[model samples]
Target chain A: MANTNASAVKKDKKITWKEIKRQKTLLIISFITVVYGFIFCYWPLTGWIMAFQQYKPKNGLLHSKFVGLDKFKFLFGDDVFIKVIRNTFCMGVLNLVTSTIMAILFAILLNEIRHTLTKKVIQTVSYLPHFLSWIIVTGILHDALSSTGIINDLLLRTKIIDQAINFFAHPNFFWPIVAFANCWKETGWNAIIYLAAITAIDPCLYEAASIDGASRLQKIRYITLPGIKPTIMILLIMNIGNVLNAGFEIQYLLGNGLVQSVSQTIDIYVLKWGISQNDYSLGTAAGIFKSAVSIALILVCNWWAKKTGEERLF
Target chain B: MNTKHIKRSLEDRIISVLIAIFMIVFITVTLYPVINTLAISFNDGIDAVRGGIYLWPRKFTMKNYTTVLAMQNLVTGAKITVARTVIGTFTALFANALLAYVVSRKRFLFKAQLSFFWVITMYVNGGMIPIFMLYKNLHLTGSFWVYIVPGMIGAWNMLVLRTYMLGLPDSLEESAQLDGAGYLTIFWKIISPLCKPVYATVALFVAVGQWNSWFDAMLYNRMKTEYTTLQYELMKLLSSVMQQSGSADTAKNSTAAITPITIRSAATVVTMLPIICLYPFLQRYFVTGLTIGGVKE
Candidate 1:
C-alpha cells in the first residue's frame, strides 16, 4: 500500500512539471491580464480612499488630511444636491417604467403581425435610434422640441394650444421628455430580448390552449405572459441597481438654465462639483455615496428575488 | 377555398387591422424626426428658420453640408473618430478575446480566479472621480491614448466572449495540444478563426460603441480640440447653435447668410449618417448578439 501511494505521488509530480511546461504561454497571457486587472480595476478601488480625505493635488492621496464624512454632510446639506437626487430618481423611474412597458407592448404587437416583410422592415427601422449617439438624439430632440418645430406647430394648428410651447424650456416637462426620449431610443432594442424570450416559449403550450378553444387573447394571456415573466422579473431586478444612472449625456445636452432644476442628475452633479470645480474629495465622496447606495439597492433586490423565487441577477 | 378552412373571425381581422395601423404609426413616430432633420439640413438656412419645413425642404440648398464639411473642426473630428473606431475596436477585441480564451480554458489552473477578478468589475467600481484621477495620474488625460488604453478590455464583452468560447467543442483544443501546438498557436490558428461569428458580433458592438462615444473625448481631450471625436464635434455644434439662437439678432448683422438651424441640422445628420448607413448590414448581427447574451442563464 505504501509503495503504491509513493508511486502515485511520483506520477503527480511528473505530470505537474509537464503541465507547467505546456501551459507556459497561457501563464504569460494570464500574467499580463492579471497585471491589467490590478492597474485598471483594482487601482481605482484603492483610490476611493481619497473620498475620506481633504485631498489636494499637491499633497497627493497619502499626504492629504483625512476628513471623515464632511463631504457627505456638505452634499446632504446642499439644496441643489437634494434637488439633483430627486431629478435623478424621477427620471430614472420614468425611463425604466416607460421603456420596459413600451418594449413589452411592441414585442407583443410585433408578434401578432403576420406579414414577414412588414415585420422585418419595422423591426429594422426601430433599432436605428438605439445605435445613434446621444449627441445625435439630443440634436434631434432639440430640433423637434424647438418652439417652431413640428410638435409645437401641430399643437398650434390643432388649437391644442393658442401658441407654440418651447417644450425644453419648461421645467415640468423635463422628466417626461427625458422618459419619452429614452423610450423612443431604447424600446425596439429592449424589445429584442422579449421577442427572443417569446420565441423560446413552448409551441405545444400555445397549441394546447388553442385545442381547448382558447381565443387569441386567451392564448396570449395564458402562455405568452407567463412564458416571459421570468425574463421580465430578471430584467427588472437587474435594472433596480441602475435607478441612479438616469444618464448624463442627454440631460447635459438638452438641459439649460430653464430646465436645470429638473435636469441635473447625480452624475451631472458629480461632474459639476467633482471634476469641474476641482474638488476631488467632494466628488469622490459623492461618487462613493452613489456607489454605496447602488450596491445596497442591488443587494436588497437580489435578496428579495431569492426570497420570492423570482429570476435574479446573481 | 372557403370550404377548405375555417373563415377568419371579425375580431381577429379587426385586431390585425388595428395592429397594422399601430405599426404604421410606430414607423412614422420613429422616422419623422430623422426625416425632419434631414429636410432642415437640406433647406436654405434662412428658410429653415421661418419654420414651415416639415418633411421636405422648402428651399433646397447643399450649402449647409458643404460648409459644415469644410470646417477644420469637423475634418479633424472625423479623422480622430475614424482612427479611434478602427484602432480601438481591433486592439480591444484582441485583448478581450485573449482574456476570454484564457478564462474559458477548462483545465487552466487560474481560470476561475481570473474570471472572478474580471467579473466583479461589472458589479462595483471606484466611480467617476477615482477613475478620472487615475487617468490623470497615468497621464492619459489630454491624450488620444486615453480612448484606446482604458477600453482595451471590457468585462461584459469579455464574459460574453468567454461564454462563446466555452460553448466551442473542447476536443478542438485537445487535438491541437496533442500535436504539440502551444497555447498561442492554438489561440491564433484554431480558436480565433473558429470564433469568427462571435468575433464579428463583438467587433460590431465595440466599433459602434467606439464610434458613438463622446464622453471619453469630453473628459480626457476636451481642451485638445484636434483630438475630439465626430460625436463631440456635433455636441459642440449643438451648443453653439443654442447659444447663437439666444443671441440671434446680434449674429444676424455680423456674418454670412448661414443660420444656426441649417448648420446644426447638417451636423446632426452627418453625425448619424454613418450609423444609419451601416444599420441595415449591422442590425442582424446585433440582434443575434443581443439574443445570445440575453437568453443565457
Candidate 2:
C-alpha cells in the first residue's frame, strides 16, 4: 500500500511539471501583459512626486525641489477651483439623473413598439452618435446653435423668441447646454443596456400583471421597473465613480473666454496648470485630488448598493 | 361596455401617435445636424456662408473637402491616425485576451487578487499628469509607440473579456489537455473561435477609441508639424483659420482661404466618416457584447 501511494505521488508531480511546461506560452504572454500594465499604468505613479515639488521641466522630477502641500493650498485658496468643483459636480449630477431617466423611458417606450423593423431602425440611429468623436459633435452643436442654424430658424418661425439666442455664450445656459448635449448624444446609446435589461425580464410577469387588470403604466411601474432595478443600481454605482469626469473635450471645445467660469472642470484646470502653465506639481496635485474624490465616491456607491441589497460593482 | 371599448381604442391610437412623433423628433434632432454639416462641406463657398443649405447642398461642390485635404499636413495626419488605430487595437486586444485567459481559470493562484487589482485601477487611476510624466521619463515622448503602448491594457475591457471567457465550459479545456494539447493550443484552437462575438466587440471598442483619441497626441506629441494625429491636425487647422480670420493676418496667409463653417464642417465629416462607415458592420455584436459585460450571472 505504501509503495502504491508513493508511485501515485511521483506520477502526480511529473504530470504537474509537464502541465507547467506545456502552458509556457500562455505564461509568457501573461508576463508580457503584466509587464505592459506595470510600465504604462504603474510607472506613471513616480510623477506623483511632482505634486509635492514646485516642478519645472528643466529641473526634472527627480531633481525638483519639494514644497509640501503648497499646490493643494493654492488650489483650495483659489475661488476659481471651488467654482470648478461645483460646476463639475452639478453637471455630473444633472447628466447622471437625466441620462438614466431618459434611457429607461426610451427603453420602455421602445419595448412597447409593435413593429420589429421600426424598433431596429430607431435603435441603430440612436446609438450612432455615441461612436462619433466629440470634436465632430461639438462642431454639430456649433452649427445647430449658430444664428443661421436650423434650430434658430425653427425657433424664429415658431415665434418662440423675437431674436436668435446666443446659447453658447450665456453662462446661465452652459450647464443646460452640456446636459442637453449629453442627452442627445447618449440617450439612445445608453438605452441599449436598459433595453437589454428589460428584455431579460420574464414575459410571465407582464402576463400576470395583465391578468390582475393592471394598466400599461401600472405594469411598467410595478413589474418592468422592479425587474431592472439591479442593473440600474449597478450602472449607477459604476457611473458614480466617474462623477468628476464631466468630459474634457466637449467642454474644452465649446468653452470660450465668455463662459469659461462655468465650463472649466478639474480636467481642464489640470490641462491649464500642468500643460499650458507648465506647473507640473500643481497639475499633479490637482489630478491626485480628483482621483481621491473618485475613489471615495466609488466606495460610497458600492456601500450603498450593498446596503440596498442590489448588485455591487465589486 | 361598447362605449368603454371605443374610448380605450381611441386612447391607444393617441399613444401610438405620440410615440411616433417623439421618435421622429428625436431622430431628426440627433441626425439632421450631422447630415447638414456634411451637406455644408460639399456646398459652394458663398452658398455655405449664406447658411441656406439644409437636407442637401444649395450649390453642390467638393471645394471644402478638396481644400481641406490639400492643406499642408492633412494627408500625413490621416496616415498617423489610421496607423495608430490599427496598431493600438491589435496590441490592446492581444494583451487583453491573454490576461483575461489567465484570470478566467478558477485554479489559477492569485486570480481573485489580480482581478481586484485590475478592478481597483479602473475606479482610480494615477490621472493624466503622472501618466504624461511616466511617458516622458521612459523617453517615449515623440514615438508612435507612445500612443500604442500606454493605452494597450484597458481594465474594463480585460474584465469583460475575462467574464466572457469564464462563461465557457472548462470541460473543453480539460478534454483538450487530456488529449496532450497545451493551454496555448486550447486557447488558440478551442477557446478563441468560441469567443468571436466578444473579440469583435472588444476590437470595435478599442478601434473606435484609438481612432478618435486626440488627447494623448495633444499632450505628449508637441512636435506640431510632424507628429499631429488627424483629429489634432484638423483642430489646429480650424483654430489657425479662426485665429487668422479673427486677426489682421488674413491677407498675408491667403492660401488657407477656407471659411470657418466650411473648414469646421469638412473636418467634422472627414474625421467621422471612417468610423461611421465601420459601425453598421459591428452593430450586431454591440447588443450582445453590452449584455455580456453588464449582466451578472
Candidate 3:
C-alpha cells in the first residue's frame, strides 16, 4: 500500500487538470468501486443501530422504539445466551486446535513421502472433501455415523460395542463430531499453505542433517517444524480473530432436537431470534457482540504479533 | 560408511512401509464417505436400508436418481444453480479484477485510500441481521441479482488479482501507453489475456462458492421456488432424514423402493455433481493461485 505511488514520483509529474484528465479511465473505475464498496460493505453498518433499539420490522428503523442497550442487557442476563456463547467458544477452540494440528501433521508427513507421483495422488484425494459444501459433508457424516451405517457394522464385528451408538443423539459427541467434520473438510485444504511454507524451506538443511546421520524423524523435528513455525504463528494469530465463528452451516445442518443444547452457535442464535422468533433487537445485539469481539481479538493479536516481531497482518 | 549406509537403509525401509500403510489408510478414510454415498445412490433405496452396502451397491438400481431427477423443484434448482455459477463467476471475476486493476495502478491517485477502504472490509462485517435487513430494504430478496451484486467485488479476490497484475512487467503498460492505448484498452487487450492463470484461480473459487452455496438460497429465496438452488433443495431432503432418523419414512410414502437414505444420498450427489465434474480443473488452478510466483512470458 505504501509503495503504490513510488514509481509515479517523477519530477515532471504534474498535479494538474491535464494529469487528472490522463487518468480519466482509472478514475472512473475507481469511482465505481468506491460506490460499490460503500453500498455493499459500508452501508449495512448503519443498520447496527437496531441493536440498541426495540426494533420492530413494521415500524422500521426510524419509528422503532429506542431501548438504549436494553437488548444487550437482556442478552447478557439470559442463561441461554450464556450457554450459546460457551458452545461457540468450545466448538471454536476445538475446531481451531484440531484443524491446525491435522493440517501441519499432514503437510509434514506428506513431505516425508519421497515418491512424487504417489504423494500427488494422495494430496489430490485429500482435497476432495474440501470442495464439498457443509450440507453434503454433514449429510455424509450423518450417514457414516448412523446406527445401521458402516461404523456401527465395524464396531459390531469387532465386538467393541454391544449395540449401535446414536452418535448425534448424545450431547458429549456433538463437539467432537463438529471438530471431526471441520477436520475432514478443511485439513487438506489448509495443509496447502503449510506445504508451501515447507517447500520454501532450504532443502540444503535436510541434506546437511542427513550427512550428520540424523534420522528422518530427527530431520523433520529439527528442520521442517522450525521451518514452518513463522507460517504457523501467522496463521494462528489470524485465526484467533475468527474464534467466534465456530461455524453455522455444519451445526445447522447436522443439529437436531437431541443435540440442540450443544449445537446452537452464535450465528444460529442470531438466525433463530432475528428471523424465526422475530426478536430482531436481541439478534442484532448478539451480532454486535460477535463483531465487537472479532475486531478486538484481531487488534489484540495484531499488537502481540508486532511486539514479538512476527509478520504482522497490518 | 558401508555399515551406517546399511543400517539407515534398513530403518528407512521400515519407515517407508509404515508411511505407505498410513497413506493408504488416510486415502481410504478420505475417499470412503464419497464412494459409499455414490454406491448408496446407485443402490436400491429399500435394499440400502438393509444395511450392508459397502463400496459397491448390493442391489443396484437407478430408481433413486430417476426419482430425484424427476422432481420439478430439483430441475428448477439445477437450472438456477447453473445460471448463478456461470453468471456469478464471470461477473465476479471481471468486477474484482477491474477493481483490483483500478486500485493497483501506480498512476492512479487515491489508490492507497481505496485499497485500505476495501481491505478493512475483510476483517469487519456489518453482521448478519443488519445485512439481511439491508437486503430486504433494497428489494434484493426473492431476486436472482441478490447472489451476483453483493458478492461482486470481494476484497480478497481483488487483492490476489492486484498482486498478480502488479507482478507483470511495467514495461508492457508503458509500451502500450506510448502506442496511444488508454487504461481500459490496456486492461482488456493486454492485461486480461496475461491474467489467465490468476483468472482461472478466481473463477474456480467463485464458481465453486456460487455452486455449492445453499444458505443464501435458504435465507433469501426460500419462498421463491423459481430461484431455488440445488443445494438448498438437497438441504431440505437432508434435514428431513436428519429430523426423522436416517431410515425414516420421509420417502416411504412415495415408494417402497426409495427410502429417505438413498433419496437424500441421490439428491446430495446431484447437488455436488457439477463441482465434482469441475474438480479436476479446479485443482489445476487453485494451487497455482495460492502460490504467487511471478509470471514469466
TM-score of each: 0.95, 0.92, 0.95
When sorted by lDDT, best at the front, the candidate numbers are: 3, 1, 2
Model 2: per-residue Cα lDDT at residue A204: 96
How is the predicted docking of candidate 3 categorized under the CAPRI scheme? Answer: medium
**What is the C-alpha lDDT profile of model 1 across A1-314, one tens digit per residue?**
87996675456445376877767788899999889878988899887878788999899988999988888899999999899888888888888999999999899989988788988899999998999988888878877777777788889899999987878778989888888899889999999999989988999998888778777877778889889998888888778888886668789888899889999988988898888999978888878878888889889988988887875554
User: lDDT, candidate 1, residue A105?
Assistant: 88
Question: Of the pair 2 and 3, which is ahead by TM-score?
Answer: 3
Q: Residue B43 in candidate 3 has what lDDT?
A: 94
lDDT of 2 by residue, B1-297 (tens): 664554554556777888898899888988898889888887766556666689888887777888878776778888889999999898889878878988897555446766776776676667778887777878888878888887788898998899899999877987888998876777789988999999999999899888888877888886855767888876765565445434534423444444667766887788899887878778878777787777564
Better of 1 and 2 by DockQ: 1
| Model 2 agreement with the true structure over A1-314: per-residue lDDT tens digits | 87996675456434365756655665576677667677767767777888999887888877888899888999999999998888888889898998998898889888878899999988888988899877767767777887677888889999999898878779999888888889988998888899888988999998988778777777878999998888888898889878888667878878888899999988999999887887878888989988889889988988998898887778
What are the candidates' individual DockQ scores? Answer: 0.62, 0.50, 0.58
How many residue pairs clash per model? 0, 0, 0
Model 2 quality (TM-score): 0.92
Model 3: residue B175 alpha-carbon error in angstroms: 1.2
Model 2 Cα shift for residue A220 (angstroms): 1.9
Q: Which runs in model 2 stand beyond 4 Å of their true positions?
A: A1-26, A57-59, B1-8, B240-258
